[model samples]
Target: MVGMTEINVREFRDYAAGLAQQAASLILTKRAEITATDDIRSHSQTKTSAVDPVTEVDTAAEAFIVDSIHRDRPDDGIIGEEGADIPSKSGVSWVIDPIDGTVNFMYGLGEYAVSIGAMVDGQYVAGVVINVVKQTLYSAAVGHGATVTYRDGTSTILRCRQETDPQLSLIATGFGYTQTRRSGQAKILQEVLPQVRDIRRMGSAALDMCRVAEGTVDAYYEHGVKIWDVAAGIVIAREAGAQVRVPEVWEKNSARGTLVWAASAELAPAFERLLSSVGANGEID
Candidate 1:
């Protein structure tokens, strides 16, 4: 029987890593099955939506992961995108987004991911984000460095972009749940477009943050992102030498929205300025 003492950070990391790998394999196989036969009956049957674009894959993946964790660490709590909310103010809590890019998944685009993060007393200690289609895993622990392992078994250390000039930096952003929410996002984009090198609207927030960690992008910011959406990615980005801050640090009541800024310290100020100029209520300046 697994006990609390046996469920250390290392053990949880290894266990989650294994499960993520297995889930990735399953996703690939399922995708291939749909592609080869052109029969999506199985896939269609499992397609359920909590919101318009969110689907059963999200719930299934979350349930599979939460169940695995509970089997070994029943005392630990879970906060998942699909399951009932479990209070996370005490002990160990795992935050999960089974499939981070639901729209991409529904459209047969292979850009979604599985995100998991473990926190102790509201502070993230370890996290992992797996790009199932790419068979890549990004992982980090509080004191340990961030690393990305590819399907070829090669692992590389990740670091955030150091580009100081906003005109030369590549930025990533995402829209919120509602059309009105997107209006605020569009306003921020319009403000930043002329200043930044380019903007990418990647569907998956987790993947967008991983891209920041991998140095493929300079930074990522989004509004209305849930705790699960950014929790794991935040750890990965910070471990990769990126500066991460919630909105509250720069303004009062900023935590009410999902605002994350990730970039090298050299460029964080400029990015923050842009965010402040366009973010809701312009509170970051």
Candidate 2:
């Protein structure tokens, strides 16, 4: 990767946001076509586990994004969930999740999103996530604060709740695809549930991170999510004033068997202590 002294993070953020918006349109168009093509479901497959579905739309979207990035910035690398990987020549790389919640998308849920994050030398510089069905967008740059836009074109600066008490804080989380892994996740949830206000099993990790950013949820913690699943969301949540510590986007499989959490600064300490108490602060599966 080529090293450069200065990088335009905001511009990169905008480009990623634009890509997410375009991909959202593509996903919506595919959804519309799915209604007419009943056999398409048969063509879909799973990854990592039986329940981790991957439709043609996901691959197509990733190809579209990879091609777009190649055309616009040939020297930049790309790492996509659909197995799009290219080496970086410009010290910049993109991490992308074409469809963050395939199960939710197939089930007609509104929690799925297209997530993109740009990094320089393995550090996040900018990120964007667009909720396809809801037409909501979240974006952030390293120095620029995060923001969320709604379907109505209205936008708001994102910020997690200040001084959100650990006991009263509502937490969001997700389960793994494999039965064995999910069983392990359940054990963590069992220990964490009674400590927070409640738990929400959102279908999308990207959107769940944005929920934490916008204060819709006080915290989010999960394990076994790939870099594409949380790269964009991590930047958004951190820029929105949420405390976060997770693996680098370029770290291969670093998130697997490791706990990742984001909470308000006020709640992070106690929440982390709680996680340690429950044996969630380290590798569990």
Candidate 3:
């Protein structure tokens, strides 16, 4: 990991955003082809759990991203959800999630994204997430504000809502793939569901965090999200005025990380307290 001082924020931000946009384009093209095919699941397979699906498009997207990064930034390490891991030689690394909501993409739910985050010495410096179906782009760089570009080509600065009242907070969350972890997640959700305005199970964590950034959701919390799932969106959320908190000790390989995001600084503590009250701040045990 390289120190933060060594990174060129704007340059890397542009690069990451471009990579994400290109990857999103690739994903959308593949999605179209898959939708036209009769056997959509023919090239799909289960991973880790029978419910955890991986499609050919996911692998192809990751390959394109990894190859692009290797050619453009050979010294930078790459870690991707589709099994691309290269050691860093330049103190920089890119985290990639080819398709954040594969299930949603497969079922034509229009809730998936391609997420890319650049980090220096394990600290995020730039990030980008593109909603493939919606054609929306969310991006951020450290010390710079977050912004969202719409399908119409107009862009707007992003900001989280200022609502501090927990009951009025429209929280977004997600479930795990395995039955055991999902059962534990259910127990936690049961305690917190009635206390908020409502709960939305958005199929994509990356997009959910982006929703927090854009004030579409007041807060978001989820357990067992891999780093690739939230790395890019978390930066956008934080830069957009949302306060985000993750586990003190992060282990990318462990499917037990907990992430919490609140719309504003004042609401973060209140949200954290609510999460603790419901025992949602810890691992799904």
Candidate 4:
């Protein structure tokens, strides 16, 4: 494994800040065309089974990003959602969720995105999530703060809502892979709905978390998210003054787990209590 490298946070931020912009531009330029969709679809060798849906765009984007990282920071390792997990040579690993909300993308919903996060010695250091269709970029670095930039070159600091009333908070959540998982998620929703202002199912975990980070939504909780799905958003959310946690603590296997993000620390307890009441264990595997 790569030992941690001491690098200036500003340098890291500058390197990653433009990533979402570039990705967004590329995706937008290619959208709504058969060749583009076919190119994206062809990447999936596996049939759209009930278990997983892999697309051509996912693989291509991962390859594109991995190559970019290797060229820019040759010492860093990469853990992509669709590719092999390689150990880091520089104590910093780049996590990639190349095309999140793939189902939406395949169906032309345009809600899918590219998410990238850098983890140093297993700790999230920086991340970027780009809404491909909207050309919106959300990025953050530890101690450097978080920002959202639009296609027009306008930017603003992201700040999560500090609402303390659960009954007034707008919550967001997602369904997992299996029916059993769905049932458990439903149970949690049942418990939390009456207590919160309302709930939304946006189908894109990365974008949903960004909404929370930007205060467009008050909180977000989901079961069984991969590291790539949340890694970058976690950094952005936390930097935007949101409270985040992997629902439970364990001696090992902390990298993959259920996650909760809320506007305030005080709101997390209520959400966790709801999950506990539903017999939901915050484990992802």
Candidate 5:
């Protein structure tokens, strides 16, 4: 039998929550700094494609989180969007997305977040996602349920809507960075739009999943999302009673794979069928 660490899920969750909030605060400060200095345009750099961007804040925030993890959990591994890779010796690895929705952040659209997830032996167990501009936080620990906390200290237990009909359920989705992938996603959306109550194209996948958890949207699905993009949101959504369909390989290039989320188990099959019908399962480009 494999040895399991004597870990406290709640404690781990608390730490992740603190880390996420700290990173988000750092990002918010940096954004303010940019605005104050009128230097927003100079801080961004494109990655993979011109549409995909990484801001200086992204790197700085990630560095702050990485430094914290190194200081607090020396034995745990880290995988971050800004290229942090540390080997795990304690069987726990932390996934970090210092800023999800960089485009939104760049444009001051207010949908970005700091997402952090913890995995033990490759299985996600705890997560924290903080919407920095909105001061909203969603968190979950395995078997401990999920909750959303606001800036005023008010908190609510997350619960997904139980809409049984696909036609009446509202779904959220996002497009990938590459033009070819965007074209394929657009085609899929054309078929899915009329069937659902409506669709929301929220730029951030992490926030989209959190919206599902909070019943703001009935479901969410996407393609080509990185591990850091959905890791934290996945745990929060699942803990809120949503069903998540992750690809077999978490690290696979989702440009050729898919990630799906639904608010209710009863509505998931219908949504899956709709996606299948539109050939949304096929690789983009």
Candidate 6:
């Protein structure tokens, strides 16, 4: 009983990594099949808004991940972007984003990914993010650190870049689908862009966070991303020594326009001060 409740972080990390890879493979195959014979848009639909799209592959991949988790970890709960909800009796839960960049995947941009995370008592302990197009995998077990496996099959431990100067930092960011949120984000970026070295807007939130973890990007911040969009990434970034800020796991309303940011430990303080000066600390209202 106590052993089962202990929730082994390594075991959870392994589970998340395996499931993310399998789901990424499923997404790639299905995406190819969909595009080979028909217009990608025909297989997708809008959810929160006309711009907020979800594709058939997204649903299919999520179903595959949910079923796999249910079969392997029966007592664990699940919360997925495609509406998978399962209650956990084992005090462990999975947050799933089957395809983190649906629009990029639909457009063949090659920046989308599959993200999976395990949380215990509202705290993330293990996570995996598999970049479908990049053929890379990122995984982390709490207190054990994080690692990224490259397309060439080489793997390396993850770490945030060491930069104390905010003006020289390369930042990554994303925007919301709604015009109101977009308008608000534009204002935020106006203030943020001049303070950083430059800003890169990659369509995928999960990948942006992973970039911060892997030192490819000095920092990342955005508004309106949900738990599924950044759960795996939050763990990966934090384990890689990035300072992370986010709303509670249960705070699922992206419409509220909350802020999420991750920066290297060396730069986090100055970055926070910069954000405060620019008024990026609260919701986008």
Candidate 3 per-residue lDDT, tens place, 1-285, comes to 455652487677789888888888898888788778666677799987998999999999999999999999899999999899898999888999999999988888888999999888788888899999888999898888899999899999999999988898999999888888889889888998889999998799899989999999899888888888888887899899888886655675776636545456757888888988987767773
lDDT of the candidates, in the order given: 0.74, 0.87, 0.86, 0.74, 0.86, 0.89
Predicted structure 1, TM vs. truth: 0.85
TM-score of candidate 3 to 2 decimals: 0.95
* Candidate 1 local lDDT, 141-222, one digit each (tens): 7777788999999999988878888889999888765555666678778888898899998799999989989999998887
Per-residue lDDT over 1-285 for candidate 2, one digit per residue giving the tens place of the 0 to 100 score: 644233588888999989999999999898788868675567589877777789999999999999999999999999999999898989999999999999988877778999999988888878999999888999998878999989898999999987547789899999887776688889989988988899998799999999999999989998877889889998899999988878543366443567788998878888888888988876655
The top-ranked prediction according to TM-score is: 6
* TM per prediction: 0.85, 0.95, 0.95, 0.86, 0.95, 0.96
User: To one decimal, what is the Cα RMSD in angstroms of model 3 from the true structure?
Assistant: 1.6
In the range 1-285, model 6's lDDT, one tens digit per residue, is 113233498888988888888888888888788888999989999998898899989999999999998999899899999999887888889999999999999889989999998888778888899999888999998888999998898999999999999899999999888888899899989998988899999899999999999999999999878999999999999999999999864565446788899999999999989999998888874
> Where is model 2 more than 4 Å wrong at Cα?
1-7, 248-255
3-30: candidate 4 lDDT, tens digit per residue: 3333545456566656655655555555
Candidate 3 collision pairs: 2-91
Looking at candidate 3, what is the lDDT of residue 44? 93
Model 6, position 100, has a per-residue lDDT of 93
Best candidate per lDDT, number?
A: 6
Q: Evaluate model 4: give its TM-score.
A: 0.86
* Candidate 2 local distance difference test against the native: 0.87
Residue 4 of candidate 1: its Cα lDDT?
36
Query: How many backbone clashes are present in model 6?
Result: 0
Q: What is the lDDT of residue 202 in candidate 3?
A: 74
Clashing pairs in 5: 224-254
